[model samples]
Target chain A: MELSLATRTVAEHTVLEVGGEVDVYTAPRLRERLVELVDAGARNVIVDLAGVEFLDSTGLGVLVGAMKRLRVANGTFGLVCSKEPLLKIFRITALDQVFPIYSSVEAATGDGTGSGPTS
Target chain B: MATVRLSFSPAPVHVRTARLVGVAVARRAGVAEELLDEVRLAIGEACTRAVALHNQYGLADLVTVEMSDSDSYAVRVIDHAPLEASVGLTKLPPDELADESLTDDALTTGVGFALLAGFVDDLVVRPVEDGSGTEVRMVWPVQRR
Candidate 1:
């Protein structure tokens, strides 16, 4: 129910840490934030979903929308999700392949020399 | 052979009520926690949609939720809103894959009927025989990974 956004710059990439539940009631806020970043010329975006407790279809739709927007601009969007429940949902929906998923925010942001994508 | 039935005003509160009842039933039926979450989310979506459409037409009526356990757990959510108000899964158009404007967060993230269809294994939405309200029946199989 609570949403928090934190921004960090890593090498030329912009990482956005999203925490909280993303549902129909909260997805609009996330979309607005993504739009703002895209408009600001952030081409490389990483969404850190480590703190996300729940994700619904509404949340998935927002992510898909963001991916489409960034793809059109020749940009990229990646995700960092460690929660098993959330990961299961993404895997079942086959969205795990739609977005590049990393194990941690550091890997997602490619911070200086961190672990690379987990298979 | 356990069933729980209740009636409440068709509003946001009903959504929460349905979720609570779903969790309770899943627990009593010894369903797994992960599957319990799935059932709760599915029921929440169905009841919320029914309530929203029912309220739009000034059809303030009691929303009846029935949770029954048989070979598998099932929920029947009925609202006094006319059947015409109910939106069918087949009637909903696919997501506009090519429209930029359609990517609006609200349009993309709103709990559409499509998501409900994907979540529940057995879902049926139809009019009551009395032609008064919409009835949504959802079944959750007992064995789930």
Candidate 2:
């Protein structure tokens, strides 16, 4: 399925909102968005996956790659995901521990990480 | 005791459709709502890998998905993707495999194999008997966890 993307800045965090099935076909869009955000210096980022119908390994890979990119920039990466399917996949891959996942974007913005680098 | 079989081109577009069919099959087999996600992910990952492998290896093939509902739900995704020459990811030592050969762009779906192995109860990858492709097999029991 095709993916839809929306982005906004909240509390200095770049919130990338995505909806649709994120698999091999559509994950590139997500990856590119994350790359662009990172290149543009949005360190503290929240990937709002609340609207995601399904997330496979491909999507998970994109998240991992994005998180790694952010980490290199010394920024925190978080996720906003409540869907059972996405949660199950994240847990299955043991990625839940790797990412700071929140239930909502508001909570994600208030995560206190802020944007850019933090001391 | 029902079986659902689906086949499509080994393309990215068909991956989601195949996954939906897998979820439906599990739902019809009395699989719990929670477990349905597992089925959907396993199927999607397998299809993604198969499609990526076929495309990367420059092979034109078809992907076949089979779901059987008996005492448990068994799903299989078959692809005619040639064995990756360098990696030959059929079964490699942990150190030798780079996250299931998730090297370049197309192979990004490499994480799918790991997710399937960890989530599904019993998962296996075998070479097609005809020596043409690979088969990813996974099963979820009817008994809820």
Candidate 3:
């Protein structure tokens, strides 16, 4: 229902903390934010979904679009998803293969990652 | 026969209405809690799609939602938005097998008709007769693993 976006820079990586339900109505806002950040030359991007209680296909679409955009620019896009229900959705869709998922924001921004390819 | 009807504007409230109705129906049908969550998500997706289409055409008025449970649970979404060329399931192109975008987790996963198709056992979309609006009916059989 509500969306709060916060951005922090860690070395050269840009961390985006998104807390809210990302559905059709709110997806456009997320897409716009990712585009702005990518265009501004923020390459390595980490999306923190720890606060996201719900996500749908539209939200997934925006994230996918951003991942492609970032990859095309030879950048990296990672995710921080902790919730089980949300994580199940990602795994069912095999998105666990696309986005490198970390257990926590610290781990995602930390040394070792899980499932997805290392950058 | 367990049934419930709700009417709300084609706005954000529609999503909540769909979710509530879906979970309620699933519970009444004695469906498992995890499966009930899937039904709720599928119904929410369908209602969201309908609302988005209606809003795009400036038809932000009352939309009727009918939830019924018989041998199967069904949710019928009715909206007065002008049916456009792009609104039906048939309008969607064949699944793009080679489109990596479609397979991408961030792109293809989660709430959509695709998820509904994957979750619900039976999904049907058709135009409502009498030249009124679109009707989307989705059914989940009572017995499933």
Candidate 4:
């Protein structure tokens, strides 16, 4: 399936809402978007994966890379996902511990705690 | 028991195709929703590895994926690379991974066997009987865990 992306600004945080299956074919689109945000000096990013149906290692790799990039820039990053399928991948790679997962976008950006991007 | 066999060019674009075929078979086999997700990721990883191996080793032949529904669900990703070309992706020791967690650089570096081990019930790696290549086999019980 094709991955559709929608981006908007929430306060200072950039919210990238991704839909469709994230796999080998569609991961690069997400990767490029993340890079673009970093290049644009956007910090405090929250990836809303609520609409994503499938995510594989390729997609996970992109998220991890984005996290590292944001971390280097002293930014904040987290995920908004509750789907069991996506959650299962985090558990498999033990990334669940690394990234703070929020149940919803409202919960994720609502915190405003500003811990900086870590996921 | 039912089985679906697919062979395709070892390219990244075809990886999703492989996953789709495998997931379709598993769904028909009555794999639960949660478990079906695992099946999708597992097949994607397997096909991805096989395709990468073939490209790295300069093998022009197709990569084969076999999904079977016997007593248990199983997927076999066959890569036609020679033994000498082995990347040894499945050789990571358990202890090496016990304390280690996923890192972006690590995931970008190479293949991931941990996901395979953690997501599936069983994983078996063996050389093809005719010494042509390697078969990465993984299985999960039909009943939900």
Best by DockQ: 2
Model 1 Cα lDDT, one tens digit per residue, B17-51: 56777789877876666677777777776776666
True-structure RMSD for candidate 3: 4.7
Clashing pairs in 1: none
The residue-level lDDT of candidate 2 at B20 comes to 79
Candidate achieving higher TM-score, 1 or 4: 4
lDDT per residue for candidate 4 within B55-99, as digits (tens), equals: 877888999998898888888999898876555564233233222
The candidate that wins on TM-score is 4
Over A40-101, each residue of candidate 1 has an lDDT whose tens digit, in order, gives: 99999888888886666667777877888899999988888877777776655556656778
Residue A22 lDDT in model 1?
A: 67
- Runs in model 4 deviating more than 4 A are A111-119, B30-34, B84-111, B143-145
Task: Report every candidate's CA lDDT.
Answer: 0.72, 0.75, 0.72, 0.78
Judge candidate 1 at residue A85 and give its lDDT.
72
Stretches of candidate 2 exceeding 4 Å from the true structure: A111-119, B84-110, B142-145
DockQ of 1: 0.23
* Two-way lDDT contest, 2 vs 3, winner: 2
Question: TM-score of model 1 relative to the true fold?
Answer: 0.71
Q: List the residue pairs that clash in candidate 3.
A: A57-B111, A60-B106
Candidates by DockQ, descending order = 2, 4, 3, 1
Give the higher-DockQ candidate: 1 or 2: 2
Worst 10 residues of 2 chain A by lDDT: A110-119
- TM-score for candidate 3: 0.75
Model 2, A32-115: lDDT tens digits are 989999999899999998888877767777887787778779998889987776777666555665677888888778745534
Per-residue lDDT tens digits of candidate 4, residues A1-119?
Answer: 58999999886789999999887778889999999999999889999998998887678778877887898899988899888767776766677776778887777787556443334
What lDDT score is found at residue B46 in candidate 3? Answer: 73
